[model samples]
Target: MVRRAGHLFAFLVVASTANAQMPPPTVGVIQLEAQAVPRSLVEPGRAMASAEVDIRPRVAGVVTEILYQAGRPVEAGDVLFRIEPSTYEADVRAAEADLAAARAAVKEAEAAVVRSERLLGTGTSQSTLDTARSTLEQARATLQSAEVARDLAQIDLERTSITSPITGIPGFAAVSVGDLVAANQADALATVTQLDPIDVEIWAPSARVLSLIEDISLDRVELAESITATLTLETGRAFEARGSMVATSQSVSETTGSRAARFRFENPRHILLPGMFVRADIVLGTANAILVPQSATEREPDGELTAWVVAEGRAVLRSLQEIGTHAHGWIVTEGVAAGELLAVDGLASLTPGLEVRTVPVELDEYGVVHDLRDAVAAGNVEAE
Candidate 1:
């Protein structure tokens, strides 16, 4: 055993001789900005516009002219299509003529009735007076029939020129020029939707719903009349808009186990549209938290988050407990102390107790590093 210890000491001496020839380690570093953060789950939502309507013709007619272009904006009562008005106009005129003729007959019958009554009092035949009375009643009935016909014909004429009932942007037209459209056509000529003000519908869990209720009931918070939400588009970045919580579904969805919450957004620019898939980030929870750069943490092969900060020129890897995430970094809960020197730049190539060279960085009003400064400021950091 003594001989084995002697050999081990000899090997250690040989290793120390070889280690003395190693060069000093140096690495580039970026200063980390720390701030309050909250750990939250991301929820997805959809874009919705309120003004969606199906345009249907009340009266059937051949399409004579299409006044509005497909996919254009129109005002309420704007002429969209023109049907053959000749038939309806002729009917209206015919009904008017009948009404006038009926009125003339009524006047003639009334005069005869008056004469018959006077003659009866002066000894005219009873049968002659009875015939005059019957003729007057028939004329009055004829006038009533003509009046009903005129009203019906006028309504038909007005319906021949189809106008938009709501003010909005119209979708593709179902019927083009010369396409014969029938009354009670299920397909719409076009769809008009209001987009200046839009709605976003999001599905939230019951727990979040409870929190929202608490905030509202306590009077410590007011529902945001204008909160920013992003819309996912088929092309380009998600559309950004400020919206207010407008409504909530009366009951939770049985299948989804979630509640539907809707917010209204003003989109005067008219960029938003209905049926767009979106993900909205609501700023919530307590703001104060310890934040660090995501890069400073080294993810283990097993996927555990680990961070290495320089402690007295030695790389000290710490297993940290994290809470929330912001644009610049993460909010850590444990395994770190305020004002500790953290290795932000060379975390990838570090192990515990490894020697390192660090350069402190300067930061502006925002936690962004600028020039060399020793002091680290503690403030609220926001996602850029």
Candidate 2:
């Protein structure tokens, strides 16, 4: 019995030694490469109308008709409402009659002056000729005054048709038919807002702006000739239209500590409305950046990001200085370099300086890690 127990103890000792000498854990890794990638900044924004105008009556009168439908598009000079035109029309006609009477009086006074001139050497006295000339001059003055009155009256008549001064979509009418409105009244008949080529106001931190400028100056980032923007709506759908930066505020807001940038986008479908909240991704430029897959990173308790890097056939825990996110990865600016192998899978089992066997892997479009060999065999990815 003692011999059998001793043999069993020896067999257990050999088994424990074999277990300690087992091969290291295998982990899937992807090599890091620096490439020129677009650097984008995302910020919340609001849509605003490029142009807004209030519709108001230019002449005081009772509203006779509303010529436009609420919320419909209107062009410049398009009539929006019709004021009572009968009164204005009558005034124009009266002024025209007065003008005609003034013309007749001027002609009669000139005839009298002619008669006086012809008779000046005979029965007509010199004083009579002078009086006739004075009367003709007075009549001519009256004719000029009457002509001005006629023109003024015509302008008032034209004001009866309330026309939009800009092309835009009109809001609800404030005055209805039979509602009295005053000329140049404080109340607006309606508001017209231009929607197409809408403006989006994006607020970016002033610090970030300074950083970007510094990066450009250092040649680390190549600024795009024209910065472009894209939007994500509140409903989580991507907007179809792409936009460009048009104007930027010169000063930062004291309250928000951010500067506002305006982007213009075509809103032909009227999908973007004034005051609509959205998310804007502004592409400022491209930079040579190292991209690390998000799946490879782990957030530590201290709120720092750490990832596993394979060096000398051992897993090394590295602290990454992530600048921003690109695609399904993070744009790392520090702590890792090009040609380094970053472990993408089996990260939880890894420890500092732990021996690891790295198998090359590739990240799919969605950032899911896949075996390179299997991916290439399935034709999902080309061998590299």
Candidate 3:
């Protein structure tokens, strides 16, 4: 009886030890909830001027005066520079004098023709009348030629005062006072850039674009009537103004395999400058989707993404159909549902069908996980 009692005691001790060693592993899990998230694509972009015009001379002359200050805003038709107008003025005066002389000659010829017609059958011969008429016609032709010359001279005079063709800020003058410039010169006198409304050019990957199109076709994404874009500067600051999609390339680039998209933004303050680098967030629409923390996912050898999810108190590895990444996680379209517990920690130790002791946890904006109890204690969440 004593030997049997000792044997029973040893059996009980071994069983207790086995039970203590085989307890389920603890894991931190976060419950996923399907919610509307903005379907957005982020791409690197560069800011460009909406309208950039080169200020060039329309007439040839020596620049006499600089009417506009460099780097100043100018309105359309505002005189920017003044060429030497003396030669143009003199040409106009000569043309006017010639026109006046031609007019007088025409009047004399008309009088002679009248006289010849009045006396054609009396004293004036037929040949004489024809000569007077021909002379009158010649005088009239001279008058018309003089009139054209006068108008052209006046146009040249007007062009001597170079004016801005657009409303924008002008750069430094390429020519100083007394510098000679020619009409339609190859070198620009200055550059005027429109800054009130600027353009940002973005190149998005073809794969991303195709995925978006697929999502739209399947009704997974609700397309906005007007797509919106926002920008982040190189300094990590958000641009104050919002933008809209203006145009997109029809063909993808062979080198980069990306399509170019242009967006327009109101830049009343002129904060965005040409050639400035930025990151653009183009929000196409919103969709009801699930976001799985990246830390909870693992990439298999077959190039598939898998995550450990708690199902019926056991770890079940699920394959996720992810479209892209958002915030700090993967934007999953399928293979997960709302109210499912996703294991965020202890993923390496988790195996299929293994019993798991799940503890409620939450991810911060940076995707770092924290225990629910600790979060509550730290006032990060309200106690439930």
Candidate 4:
């Protein structure tokens, strides 16, 4: 009887040991999906359109007619106002008359010269020929002067029709019908802007930009001549417009260590206007970062990034790499692998070296879902 009892005790001890050695069902694990993402720290600028100008007439004569409504589109050479052309018209008529008179004088002088020459052949005094020659020269000078005056008058007349200098959408008009606009008036007829294509200006840290240029490929397929950028409008909605990095500042700003970069976007609908503030996304490069859901991570007192990994059926602690954030998750630049399993749920009671039984979890087709129960239950999900 004593021998039998001892054997039974040994058998029970062996069974318990075997059960302890077996891992408990896992709580949950979400597989990591590799996604190409960009650094999202964005800076905004009050962007101006490609061209903006106050439509000031070179020659002013305003107060006639307002051709365009404020904030209306205008075409180049479209008449915006009618300056009193009466004065210019009178000047032109006067010049024309002067020209005619000058021509008449030339004809009279030529006739006198002919008569004088006939007299000289008939033995008239040399003084007659000299007088006739002087009259012809005076007529020639007057004719040249008249022609120049007429040209000046015509130019002045043309200026009486105040016309749009450029093709653009017009802004407020300062002057109205019957208001006298002085020559070279500072007050503009209207403001015009080219809105079909606009610019987005962004500022990025100097160091980060330099690193991207060095590490990221210059000949990247998307960056043949420019960098691709996505613009977010003021309403928090992304614009359908795609922009390319067209220019960069020559030097870093001493005050902010930020340099200016410009991207060009096509604003066909005129939805974006000049001076509109917008945020932009600039893709630097693709990084092989350890990305995990936000729930599985926690911060320590020292501000270090921490994660719970299951190793050998026990909870394991790990410090995250120093890379920045990615879309919807954090990027662990180091201390992680591409194919490693990461805890996605049941992290509340996680402890180092804790036993767990893990089942596999998977994302949905849209890559937006995870089934933690599938990872933790009869498929043997549990927590230690």
Candidate 5:
């Protein structure tokens, strides 16, 4: 037992000596710097048609026919449904007869007045002439009333053929043939939504909106030139066409603390549909921002995101408040500052206060780094 203990002690001493003689681990690091990063406001939004019209019956009657196929494109003045026109036609005929009778009555009253004037102070008394003139006036008023009625009847007859008011694609018909629909029904017979040049509704935070207004007031950024948007569909695929800013809400919402913004995109093929969910990338302008490679960041067990950086020839852990991704790297809003040497490789042996040998590295456009020792020098990355 004593001999075994002595051997174990010798083994421990040899291991300690070997470890102490080993050199510090070599780590690859790139110096972080503030660059003019194109800033963007990203938000989830919904696609909506620029124009949507609900087709409702203008006159009450039984639906005689559904003129349009469900979910088909239609043009303005295209008949979508046909209400039974029998009643409206009958009313029009009746109004026409009334108008003709009124005209005949007006003619008869005028002739009577002329005859009475010819007989004035003779067989016809003054009282008779006065009565004839009053009758003529009444007949003229009746004629005007009849004309109005005829016009109203004609309008009703025309409305029996319910046509689309706008050029758009129609949704499914709410009412089938032979269904009785009331005039100006609460439920629409069909809904037509204009597809081309759709509107993308954006909801951005109120604080960001204020900041934008401030920037514009200071003449720091021209929104008309700098603002542009892109859409990413729910499937994670990017939309091919770009979008332009339309307008912003006059006031922010008190409940949500966000303002509504709209963008217009030309959807010539009707690829984007109404009510579709999308992510809008609204680029405001470019600003200087500190960026670090995502490879250098690590999440601690306590849920804090951290990155290892070189300070005074030793590894230092920095708590990072990440904003978002930019240029294939993380845009950090807090913690690590500009010109900090952040370790990109050899992190397995990294510990706080541990001495580290750093090889200066350079990142490409994709945030991919190459050691300065093995590749052509892009820029001198010195430790801060």
Candidate 6:
């Protein structure tokens, strides 16, 4: 009888151990729903001046003075440099003196002509009168020439005061005081670039942009109203003001297979500068897409993606491809169908083919938990 009791005790101990090892299979499950998302594409681009001009000399002379401070903004017609005006001024004075002399000579010739006319029938000869008249006409022609020379000299003198052709920021002066510069020199004295209302040049894929344009045309969408763009500077900060597409290339580049697109943006604060590397976020169009919560998605050992779903009262795994993110979730491009009961919480204790007690869960508009079952269901579908 004692031997029988020992065997029975051993059997009880083994049964208790087996019961302790077995874990209860239960997991929370929520119905998966597909959400529509809008998409945007980012393209590389660079900022450039909307208007740039070379500050060149109109008339060559010795640099007498520098009118503007280096690296500062200037208004249109603002004097930037001053060439020596002594030579031009001298030429003007000489022309004026020549004009005065011509006037005096004309007066003397007219008087002689009058005298010859009075003596024509007396001792004075006709040739003398003719000579006087010719001299007066010559004097008048000389005066006309001198007047033209004076006007030209004045023009030259005014050009000596070099002024900015456009309102912009002038760069450093290439030449300083007492430096001789030529009028037709290849090099420029300085450069002026417009800072506000800059342009961003982006080379986007030809096929993609063309397709977007065609889609807009087919849908009768307004190009200006439907499209929008923003700039992200090289420092990785987004610009406050938005930009708009102003112009595009007529043909695609054969080498890069992209077409050049120009966008205009207001830079009233002068934050954006020319030759800056930037990123362009172009909103092509909107489309419907399916999104799953990122928390529910798992990365497998093989670098693939997976998620647990409750199928037929057991844990099941489904493969998924997360293309991007949208509305607090991963946008699944493929795998997993709609209306499946996906396990979102308490997944650590569950494995494939394991029985799970599921509790229904709901998500709010912001992807936060809205409502959950108070008690876990005992049976597959009915609450205990």
Q: Who is ahead in lDDT, 1 or 2?
A: 2
RMSD of each: 7.9, 4.2, 4.6, 6.9, 5.5, 8.1
Residue-level lDDT of model 6, residues 170-212, one tens digit each, is 9898988999988867899999999888999988888767665
| Per-residue lDDT of 24 in model 5 | 84
Superposed model 2: Cα runs more than 4 Å off:
1-12, 97-148, 299-305, 373-384
- Candidate 2 positional error at 220, Å: 2.3
Give the clashing residue pairs of candidate 4, or none. Answer: 24-357, 25-357, 25-382, 26-357, 26-358, 63-178, 63-179, 376-381, 377-380, 377-381
- 206 Cα displacement, candidate 2 (Å): 2.6
Q: What digit string (tens of lDDT, one per residue) describes model 1 on residues 1-384?
A: 999999999999999988986654644344334454543334677878766778888888888888887667798999888898999999999999999999999999999988888888677788989999899999999999999999999999999998898888887778877788888788888788888788889887877677656644654234444444445555757666656677778898888878887878778777767887766666444334467677567678987778777678777878886654656566665777776776654356677788877656533435554423223233232111
The RMSD (Cα, Å) of candidate 3 is: 4.6
How many Å off is the CA of 311 in candidate 3? Answer: 1.8
lDDT tens digits by residue: candidate 5, 1-384: 999999999999999999999988888888788776666778989999999999999999999999888777889999999999999999999999999999999999999999999999989999999999999999999999999999999999999999999888999989899999999979999899998889999999988777767755754444456478999999999998999888878988899999988999999888899999999998887555677788778878998889999988899998986545665677676788887788998889998999988887777777677777644344444432
- Among all windows of 10 consecutive residues in model 6, the one with the lowest summed lDDT is 375-384
Global lDDT of each candidate:
0.72, 0.92, 0.91, 0.74, 0.86, 0.79
Model 3 global lDDT (CA atoms, 0 to 1): 0.91
| Count of clashing residue pairs in every prediction | 3, 0, 0, 10, 0, 1
lDDT of 1: 0.72
Per-candidate TM-score against the hidden true structure = 0.60, 0.82, 0.82, 0.70, 0.70, 0.62
lDDT tens digits, residue span 241-346, model 2: 9999999999999999999999999999999999999999999988888998888898899989999999999999999977677888888878899999899988
What is the clash count of model 3? 0
lDDT of 4 by residue, 95-188 (tens): 9999999999999999998888888957767898999999999999999999999999998888877777777788777877787777776877
Instruction: Give per-residue lDDT, candidate 5, residue 363.
Output: 72
Residue pairs whose backbone atoms clash in candidate 3? none
Off by over 4 Å in 6: 1-39, 95-148, 218-222, 284-384
